[model samples]
Target: MTAAVFNHEGPWTEEEYLALGETQQRVELFDGSLHVTPAPTPRHQNISGELRAALRAPVREAGLHVLEAVNVRLRPGRIPIPDLVITGPIDFDELNVEAGDVRLVCEIISPSNASTDKVLKMHYYAAAGIEWYLLVEQDSGTMHLYRRRGGHYTEQSVTRPGDLLVLTEPVKATIRPEDLVP
Candidate 1:
């Protein structure tokens, strides 16, 4: 589905934002424009859960917060609900993300969201100064990791179901490839 380019001038409020959450659909708000994405499949959920479980131990011990599918406000009207996001301390509220609290954000790629996740969201996340971005594609069983550098993502690494994800920032959290594949 495509979202019309609205002539809206005001910022979308919390109520209006939450109202759209009913469909259980995933969409991102960028400068008053909305980009809608399809709901993930069962395999997507399994991989996401696996990623969460792999990191939960280190995250909890380090007092870091790991959240799934929450709106991370990048600017006045730019908010993207990353599939998985980890912060030092997390706020469970719907519209809770500020600018820099998010250390690493991730997305699980499905057929409908491949381009947006790999290109659009990658650029935006780098611009937002989020330290790391992880993209997992369940179809191919591949994970691509990107690290932000000088307002852009400079490091790109690809891993399959047997590799390990080594993160550089926040904490040195690692995830085996098997842990991320459904």
Candidate 2:
């Protein structure tokens, strides 16, 4: 496995990035640069699992697919791995999915990566034609849902720990925010 590239190794091209070997850590591509992050903690995994569980039946019923921490190539120089992705079942040979293939992209905000998730990724997902984006607050069990409109996204729902989060766009599923915590 390739070691994490910490320092600026100069801007990387798409081909160069794809040719590199995979490591256990998370590495995102943005504007031809590489940003490597550490693996998620157990708390992050728990939240992702809870939501995935809640959505499984609904996703199957609707004939949609859900995956965890997969690479999404939104554009040539933009790639982001969301905590979960809700999209149609697609058959492809590549290691990543195009942003157009995704209906909803979910990110659980890590304390140190809040800005990247809330700002940078939010903008990228919207710009790439992803219709829905879910930003989960890892510590507080809050979900901020954003819907794309006119090249941008606007907040559609702010669900708290006790709220029964009802998603209606790509599919209909009811989730409890509290269940997202361990």
Candidate 3:
């Protein structure tokens, strides 16, 4: 099979960005630019797995789905692969999920992408009309939940390691940040 080759230049169009297909690293499109990020660290993956386990049952009961590191098309020229997402039913053949189908988007923050997750993605998710935003800080074992209010988000709760994060919207689930890591 032949490899796909393209110019490594900026101002990439949506079709051009999608043409890169599945890559070894995470690639996202933002404002006509392609942003490439390395894969998550082991600790990050562990936390993500734990959180997924915690939310699985509850989300399933609500007839929703929880996915990890999937392409979410927020709008034209904007697609991000969130750490975790709670979404409605999706077809198996689809390349990406639309923002409307996504009820919640979670980001496990590491030192490398702290600012991007906390600020940039936060703004984009909110503007996309995704109802819930979850931020998990890998270093501190802290979780922050936000709910969309108009075109922005309002912090609903912040739970630390020892405390339990009780969520009702999108799905009903309780998670303890401390349990996210071994």
Candidate number of the best lDDT: 3
Q: Rank the candidates by TM-score, best first.
A: 3, 2, 1
Model 2 regions more than 4 Å off: 1-9
TM-score of each: 0.84, 0.94, 0.94
Global CA lDDT of candidate 2, please?
Answer: 0.88
lDDT of 2 by residue, 1-182 (tens): 35435443778887777766576788788988887889999999999999999999999999999989888999998888899999887765668988888999999999989999989999999999999999999887899999999789999999998788899879999888898988
Evaluate model 3: give its TM-score.
Answer: 0.94
Query: Per-residue error at 72 for model 3, in Å?
Result: 0.4
Q: List the candidate numbers ranked by lDDT, top first.
A: 3, 2, 1
Model 3, 1-182: lDDT tens per residue?
A: 01333435558777877788888888888988777788899999999999999999999999999999998999999999999999998885788899999999999998988899999999999999999999998976699999999999999999997899999888998999888976
lDDT of 3: 0.90
Which segments of candidate 3 are over 4 A away from where they belong? 1-6
Clashing pairs in 2: none
Count clashing pairs, candidate 3.
0
Report the lDDT tens digits of candidate 1 across residue range 27-131: 677765667766889999888898888788777777788888878888767888888988866566545576588988989988877898888889999998898
Number of clashes recorded per candidate: 0, 0, 0
